[model samples]
Target: MSQNQSRVTEFILVGFPGLHREYYGLVSFVLFLVYAITVIANATVFFLFVTNRSLHKPMYYIILNVSVCDFLFSTTTLPKIISRYWFQSGSISFIGCFVQMCFVHYLGSVNSFIFSLMAFDRYCAICHPLRYITVLKSSTVHILSVTAWSIAIIVPLILAIRAYPLPYCASNIINHCYYDHIGITLLACTDRTLYSFPAFTSAMIILLLPLSFIVFSYCAILIAVSKVADSKNCVKSLSTCSTQLIIISLYYVPRCFVYLTSHVGIQFSTDVRVVIIMLYSLGPPMVNPLIYCLRTKDIRECLVKQFCISTGHPKAQVSVVTN
Candidate 1:
């Protein structure tokens, strides 16, 4: 409860130091392109789910959640960065910084939870085919979705509340692309360890716990598939899990490296850090919908129908998402 415990009025976000102002226009364009793709790709899946009743199944519902989270996740961080580059405005109000930090972390946690839930659903569908319907009933899906959203929202709230009263009597400059929890917290005049350790620990728990669950769920799945009577069906089922694994890998593998780089005292240049963050954060959302359309026949068919109608080529089964 010192002077540094007072809330800040605003924080200046210093985007990539290596990215010179001369290249701001280039960076802005790139950020805008990535944001547009992220939004459009996820929005396509969301639109299809909302308008088409055929996609109302349990698996599709999980996908819908993924799309929603992706869209929100991109929204929470990208626009501010875009504005920073486009308009040369990197100053975010204290509350606005908190809002961005909260949503970025919360939506990320929600996505992690949803991925685990999706793994669990797949495990049930493939391993307990007979009980799949009973196990993942509509009501159960609703409860799980609500639980995921609630947990995600609460975890960040606790962290924000803890840091809310911290005095920011020092330079209110965040040396990052956007208003991130650690970046914002680093600006405070208090002992950095006081907030950093807890933030780091909670992040690890949020990340590792669900990841462990996902691995276990998939292990259970592989074992179950190995015991199946028909080899072809077993392969088919494994393929499904493999596709999902690709999505999981795309989302998580970079994070593992980033954590390693930070922990082992490996130095990444400002531009390198920014690029790394953009890849993991924006890459998965941009690619996930395309994965669904290409890897699954049902989703592919649905998208084709939508494409043909929109282009007025009703006879052709086109994959417009690719284009």
Candidate 2:
């Protein structure tokens, strides 16, 4: 390690640069609100999944995985930025920054894999209806979930291991809301491409591999749905997929745009880039629970049942169907 590395003990996170101090409170409040909502909503879903045995099927199992991922992702990224704005504390220890980067990328890769898992679950349910139950038994789902989460850790750990000892002697200012691979690597004194290219490659592989699977799965699903003779059944099948499709779009589209633009030489100002990044990163966590609650009948029914039970109206409880 270079002497400069020792000199830079902490990094300053310049969140949404050039904003006047007057708006700090407003930004902090909004960010805090988002963090609060994301935590509560995701926690509610996790609680429902845990407490209600009826929600233990493969699809809901995948949903449970998603809620857990969303919860972890938000917890990993939000609090520091909220503190940065609220308490005017943007300084993070070098080791803390690297740890944050590792978990941020790790959770993001896990999310990609989980979405692909969800797509695969839907594919099994709709395309292989006969084998769905046998193929995706609870034990099988647990195995797959463990596999996805376990495999997703490798690239991020590798990236962190490689990047952690870099000579970050030049600048200690991260021009983003939170620590991320690229932002932190760019601060290193060495040629950043040495670290960045591998990170980019890993990101693409992590993103596109599952994305390819998701696209193929959904297309096959559409074909299968088309073959169904009954209009009501077809409609029902598509309706069942609607929520995942919306979430998939929300998660992937903006990310693709950001990656594509950066790779192809299309440039965005730091503020614009950061804003876009924050929007895509934070937007999904905030909206995923809302989408599930409004769009998932079982979850809604469970919520209603819980609400009714809490309010001393057990008679008003809605029965949640076990799939």
Candidate 3:
């Protein structure tokens, strides 16, 4: 610590610096609604997965992991920002900021890995039907899930550990809504490139590695689907993969654009950048449950059955068949 450098004990989060004061309530309300929807939808999916024995397969297990990650990520980030805008409270302790940063990146990375896992699962199912069952056994799925979560922790922790010791003698006001790696590190009173480059590289690796595998998996899946003589089976295979593809596009495309623009010197306004970040981060969690419910036959049937049972319509029956 330099003698001239003063330690920052807390940080102020500026939700949207350019926005007028009158819209604070509206912004806060919208954020609250997003939070509420994300929580309810993800919780419902998770509950269905837990209670329904029929959903106890490897594919649903992966979906269950994603549901847990989505809700957990939203929970980690949304409350503070909502409070910041709603209550005019934005101060967060320095340690608290770093803690939030850890989880934000941690969950994001976990989701990336989980998506790759989903792609792999789909690839096996579509490309090699004979070995799919043996390859993605219950124990294998458990090990992969645990490994994805465990490995995702390392990069963020290292970034946090590195950034925590930097001298934050400059401004404590973060320009964004929540604690994130670049948002906090840029405030340090030193050369940010040393930290920023590594952070950027790690982020790219976390994103691109899974993305590459997903592409490869899908390409192989497409080739396999082309060989199927039965058009119905081919369409069914494509339909199953389409849902995962929509989700992957939602998760990756915006993120890739953001990272690429930064790398290529194309800059967006702070508000625009923050809004884009919020959209990509919050959008997937909000819609993932809906996507699964509408697309997956088993989950949809289970949800409908549960709804009927809860409504005291035990004799009411529903069945969904997709081809």
Candidate 4:
């Protein structure tokens, strides 16, 4: 192959294959609305957490971190996609694609880890209420928070670096929504499997580690809750956990399907597969804030109190345990 042919300077993301030109307008409009809602919803949670002094506890801090991750996760991929569908512009510079791919994967991995930390916090809070304060002190939260961000960013950086020197001689058209490792690696003129498989396996490992941790912690939580003599206490414990469990499943289940489909000979049309991918990446951030607000008492209290006080209403208390 000629040297010039091997040098790839940019890539074209074909937003969602099979949609063609007819539906771009509608798709763009919907994406814009979803993007707006995602930002607004998570930002409100993050802002509330920051502004409210009563929310300085460990669990709320975890939610605050998750909120920030949710905002960034959507921000990384949505704007690029919105512009692609809106303007018929899908071209992204090589460096720009690298940055996007890094953050998309980075924030994803971070969210998984963050969820695991939350599971740990819940376990301590419920199973060992006395030690909970000591286990998740402000210092510990800061360390764990920094660790999640650092590892998430570093691992994806290594993956991106691995793809850095690869030559894209064939074509630069990415067949999915945003600049993901799989889509970008597929365009490389070299052995696509050679480049793709290792990265795929690494990602699976990163995903599974947290998933395993979450499972074990939640199981332990179940055991602890079961031993409680009061049935009401047991139910309350399980109820608090149910929302986190739902959020965890939302984040990981579709991802497992997408990953397993490749190796198991499952067939999905390009559009269907892309739709699944969109849900995997976008669903958690959209649903997490709602689940927390609707399920958790303290955060709703924080939200209501913050809104009311900010609007000049008298101080008030709010508490409703959702069943």
Candidate 5:
């Protein structure tokens, strides 16, 4: 298998077989609901961050970026998948496959990196409140966010270019998964490590390294919150941080499993792969607004008011007893 042998024409994407069989209607309904809810939820965050002056601070600024990333990440794959399923065509062209893989990974990696930035922001805000204003300036947050996406895009682009020219004339079936380094390597005739090495390293950096930083930052935040003199302040800070922690854990766990635990050469069951894919892809966008609405008082009120008005229902006042 010469290096030149890797160059190929097109690839096939076997759309999730789990939904293709008996659960098509159910799966479609679930995805549609999730997609609608995710879009509205993330868009609300974006809108609030943009329109509200009170939300102009660094923390909500970072949250806005996270929302944007979640929206893009979900849109990269889920919509097209729904369309293909409805239209009864499971195949994606070679170019379509490559672009989808690139965008999905690019956005997913950016989301992870931005979450790290959020952790850092939370750390500074909670652990060093006095210096928070100066430490996490708007420019600094912007730089970090931009840098996160820039690196995410460049690394994937290089890897895609290097790995793409390979020949796939033997088998065109790319499976339904996106950004699968192992799957691509298994189908390739030449050395897989060249592509896998950079791809693996990038994944480790994007997934593990930022994850370590987030974990460390949260530890520091928890310690700092514990030392606060005001019990009310302590409770408030802990509540916010705990919510962030839960959301972070939810977002990171499935990703860590996919990137870290899954064997490189082995193939996973269709059901397992579909379930895992659905969980991570849908989790962030769906759960994010729920997190914000649950944890933040203002956003929750706004949502409730908006919902009450939309449905013409009585605005039920629920007391938030923060312990």
Candidate 6:
């Protein structure tokens, strides 16, 4: 490639043009608050898992890692978005775009992988309770974590590198908040099929395939739990699985909507785009810790005890994570 045909130096972002004129201040403020809360929430979850022995189990381990990924994933775009939305500068360097895409893809993949693992963990716990510890040993967990992260990083790196090989003489206006393929494709003189192929594959692996696994595994788990003669055990299992199912749906619905709309050639308004992106990126991180606190008795009890100890309440107060 000639010097002019090299990777873009900078691209102008056109984040929600319609929303930009109306309610810019309101949207920016709301996004800022969501970003801040997501960081704090995920960080707290990771910290809790690290400090609390009661939470040092396989399930919490996956949750802690998921929180870490969510924290990184949200940070990849929100800060720049806050700057652009509030300060009227929506430009990102080509290198910056690549880095943004890398981290976003990596963390998203890691989050998906962790979700799959969590499903399997629940399966083992419910179906083969006696062998849970042996099945998810420390060595196996470490290997799985490393493998997930490696694949997430490696695939994105290859795609980003390959995408820069062609010319980029088209308009440098990125029509999205971040380094999404649709925005970048508009900048390419070529067909942009190279970028699309990898992204399509990655999406299938990260979202659809894992979702299939989660749904199937949970279904099996529910069936297995129903086989127990004890009503108390059945109720307990149903409650726990229901919580997981709810969280999975919350995490997935926005993404599925975006993907389906894009595939169906449905054009989203700038305001709609902004709203959907924020919902997809921010909701999971903020909701995860709340889910754990509300769903698990031990975590809630521990928090209550800790609260009582600090506040000198003489007794623990029950608290729930409200929506």
**Residues 1-323, candidate 6, lDDT per residue (tens digit)?**
36665646788876766664667778789878988888887776766666669877777777777777878877887888777879988888877777787777677777777788878878888988899889997677777877877777776676677765557775777767777655665577877676787778877777888889998899899889879999999988888676667677877788888888978999887668866886777788778778877887766666666666678775334332221
Task: Please give, for residues 79-151, the per-residue lDDT of candidate 1 as tens digits.
Answer: 8888999999999888888888888889989999999988988999998889999999867988999999997
- After aligning candidate 5 to the native by TM-score, how far in Å is the CA of 77 from where it should be? 0.2
For model 1, the stretches where C-alpha displacement exceeds 4 angstroms are: 1-8, 317-323
Q: How many residue pairs clash in each candidate?
A: 4, 0, 0, 0, 4, 0
Instruction: Using lDDT, give the best candidate's number.
Output: 3
lDDT of 2 by residue, 191-297 (tens): 88777888899899999999999999999999999999999999999999999999999999999999999999999999999999999999899899999989998
Instruction: Give TM per candidate.
Output: 0.93, 0.97, 0.97, 0.94, 0.86, 0.90
User: How would the candidate models be sorted by lDDT, starting from the highest?
Assistant: 3, 2, 4, 1, 6, 5
On lDDT, who's better, 3 or 6? 3
lDDT of each: 0.85, 0.91, 0.93, 0.86, 0.75, 0.75
lDDT at residue 1 of model 1 (Cα atoms):
39
lDDT of 5 by residue, 103-191 (tens): 87788788888889989988998888899889899888888888987888886677667767776646766556343555565677766
User: Per-residue lDDT of 1-323 in model 3, one digit per residue for the tens?
Assistant: 66534567899999888989999999999999999999999999989998999999999999999999999999999999999989999999989999999999999999999999999999999898999999999899999999999999999999999999899888899998889999998888889888888898899899999999999999999999999999999999999998899999999999999988988999999999999999999999999999999999899899988997888776665333222
Off by over 4 Å in 3: 1-7, 318-323
**Pairs of colliding residues, candidate 5:** 6-166, 6-167, 7-166, 7-167
Local accuracy of candidate 4 as per-residue lDDT tens digits, 1-323: 55855567888989888887888999999988888888999988888887877788888888888889999988889988999999988899989999999998899889989999989989898988999888899789889999998888877998899987787787888888888888888777778777677887889888999999999999999899878999998998998888888888998898888888878999899889999999878878888899988888878777777776777666343322222
Clashes of 2: 0
